[model samples]
Target: MSSAFEVRGGNRLKGEIIPQGAKNEALQIISAVMLTSEKVTIHNIPDIVDVNLLIELLGDAGVKVNRISRDKCEFQADDIDLAYLQGADFKKKSGRLRGSVMIAGPLLARFGKALIPKPGGDKIGRRRLDTHIIGFEKLGARFNYESDDNYFRLEAPGGLKGTYMLLDEPSVTGTANIVMAAVLAQGTTTIYNAACEPYLQQLCKMLNSMGARISGVGSNLLTIEGVTSLGGCQHTMLPDMIEIGSFIGLAAMTQSELTIKNAGVESLGIIPEKFRSLGIQLEIKGNDIYIPSQETYEIQTFLDGSILTIADHPWPGFTPDLLSIVLVVATQAKGSVMIHQKMFESRLFFVDKLIDMGAQIVLCDPHRAVVIGLGRQHPLRGITMSSPDIRAGVSLLIAALSAEGKSTIQNIDQIDRGYQYIDERLRNLGADIKRV
Candidate 1:
């Protein structure tokens, strides 16, 4: 059943909140469990819809899943039903999860064959699988797409042979997928222009612990020395940096004082600085981030006095995932700023909903939007809106919380896909929101 969030706006939420495990990291790490027959223990798994759905799919693949706790689990893929990969149920489930594609690399590497349905998630833009497919082909895997059921089949008849390849783009999932495949391939593999996000780094570290020989973890150029087999290992996920960034935006938007606990501050490269550039005052104490209630915040301009522009880049840069939060937070700041969403063309489309709520945002194009801050002088008035994607859903939720009147947000399932018990968490923080 579809649900909506009924938010009574203008509530200054206060209290501390801890972010869930990194969703992106959880997806990759959980999928890596398929690489070994031994038991792999994972900690800090997010109890979100998408992650849970992936776990369910894994269970259906004949993996032994022990639910150790809400945030932890153990997986043993010793008896995987390889035939299940081509079943109708697998197609239906995996097709709905974009992260399901990552499982192919592990399955192919371990079992010499894999099949994945056309994966789906947020309809942000054209998230191509070419990087993954091409990388696998370079590793000596034969690829075939069956249009009848929309499944991509990969087979390594003679097992995978490692080779050097440069990625066209530093796709996070693509890099992780290729790395997982190359880790068990025969001989050496060198990947240039690989994604070096903290989550990817975590995956590499975990794979190494499992006996996979991989080096150059935190750098774009990765060298993998293939090992005959991998063993079981325990890995813990970092706090979701995107969620941490969202909390900073939320505190600034509602003029609320919030402390985000166990934020994994060290791994959050450039996220804090990006939020700070928006003039949101935040203090890092130990591992927690303290954001004080602010009457108003201003946007920082460039050194040349030009209008500030916030754009997304690969790791070590502002993440594209949080650009929606940044755009929504910029709506009520004390200055004008340009939000350049270079990665996904449709990401900036959610600004129209904010504009309807009285935020002065100019939709320049599909990729860029100019936000003129209301400065809290003219507070936004609430209205009914629908969530288009996960990040945009949370962005709208933040805008609705800061608006003047009651706001109704439909399609809340999108929000639930990424956030773990978000409504309950916000309620604990004094937000006047409820599910309907």
Candidate 2:
């Protein structure tokens, strides 16, 4: 995929969108199934490039990857041909996806120890893995970091033993690591202040299906009783809430009515409330969400009926990943709203693209931005734009497509990393998007 492009905006989207499975959750869940040498069958795995790439990487090192159905997969790591994970491309690709860190725990559990190269994903800011390291260390894993060598090696020479550990932050990846490692440990392991996001919860459920003992399904605390081995289990992936949120923003911005079937309403907990603040209506009927075409959604007023603020926090709070979509939607909203991206400092940098398209916004700092919506006041003329990160880039593409003309967004590779066949998927619902 080329890294650049031009966009002619101004198109209203109209259609029905069935959300895909969550990529983040699928990645971690697949890795977690490696606890035992047994066969694991998974369903609803998105047929995207990254998933294929991960499968290829695993296959080369000798893990059986098979297709049982369109969205189903059967995998077994009984024959791990390569004991040492040494390859530039593998390391680089592993670093690309958010779930790459998850394989660390599974690898250790299978091989007793493993070498991890520095991970790569969104360059929002310094995404720390200290919590993951500390949690593993508490389970009797020792680490050796080699800066010049670009290798981070760790080992559980005496095997991992269950221990109580607290996460410094509600990191999804860190929590996943601990969960994976503890499943095969010697005793009971407790994780406090852990990330209980839908993805994390999905991982736990998948692990349990594979015979791992876990308590506290959807809370900040987790209890895992180590098991000697695990066997294959059939599991389905959850709907992508982030993608659903993106579609809601797209529908609102383009005045396009859309039906998101089986939207995983249960996982959308406080997300709807956050989007509602921007006047985006997500009407639920059974498992579907109805986002009607509206010229401009109204932003909520404050307690004094002035103005309300929309900010991102940890899980159970508004997801920082969806804030980019919110910003794009706010441009067409009736009133002004503040967007606080407290998690990553560089996340707000992409606002410059929206600003260039004539959206009124002020970048307060690295982590804050105040958007004064145009309220259908001025039509946004499409212009050339490039995607910076996965979420922001796709949000920009949505904005560009929802604007006034034919828009071509570049750096689509980043967008493809998360959204599977986004152009085709959106086009099925009447969105005019094509990759050049």
Which window of 10 residues has the lowest lDDT sum in candidate 2? 3-12
Q: Lowest lDDT 10-mer window, candidate 1?
A: 111-120
What TM-score would you give candidate 2 relative to the actual structure? 0.96
Where model 2 places Cα greater than 4 Å from the true spot, the runs are 1-8, 82-93, 96-98
lDDT (Cα, 0-100) at 278 in candidate 1: 90
* Predicted candidate 2 versus true structure: per-residue lDDT over 163-254, tens digit per residue: 88888898988889888999999999999999989999888888898889999989999999999888888888998889999988888888
Q: Evaluate all candidate structures by whole-model CA lDDT and list the values in order.
A: 0.94, 0.82
> What's model 1's overall lDDT?
0.94
Instruction: Pull out the clashing pairs in model 1.
Output: none
